[model samples]
Target: MGVDGVFVAEPVSNVLGGLACLLTMYVTVYRRLGR
Candidate 1:
């Protein structure tokens, strides 16, 4: 069960982490351009 849980959590964490990174970059870029 621990291994299965880790497997499931990994993909979800990756997706959320990717999304957070994208959002952070987008906001930073948008702020810098002042648009």
Candidate 2:
């Protein structure tokens, strides 16, 4: 159960991290263009 949990969590965390990175990049670009 512990191993399974880790496997499931790893992908979810990775996806969330990726999305956060994309969002940060998008915001930075948007602000730069806005100026």
Candidate 3:
């Protein structure tokens, strides 16, 4: 990752993973609240 072109894909993967995690947490909380 040291100045290599491979580092370009980092942001995309991070955004995707973050969105997935956020959605999962939202669903979990909603289910627990029963709303």
Expressed as tens digits, the lDDT of each residue in 1-35 for candidate 2 is: 59999999999999999999999999999999999
Alpha-carbon TM-score of each model against the true structure: 0.79, 0.92, 0.71
| Candidate 3 TM-score to native | 0.71
lDDT digits (tens) for residues 1-35 of candidate 3: 56555676788889999999999999999999996
lDDT of each: 0.97, 0.98, 0.88
How far in Å is the alpha carbon of 2 misplaced in model 3? 13
Candidate 3 residue 5 Cα shift, in angstroms, is 5.8
Model 2: lDDT of residue 34: 100
Q: Give the lDDT ranking, best first.
A: 2, 1, 3
Error of 2 at 15 (Å): 0.2
Candidate 2 Cα lDDT to native: 0.98
The regions of model 2 sitting more than 4 angstroms off are: none
Candidate 2 lDDT score at position 20:
100
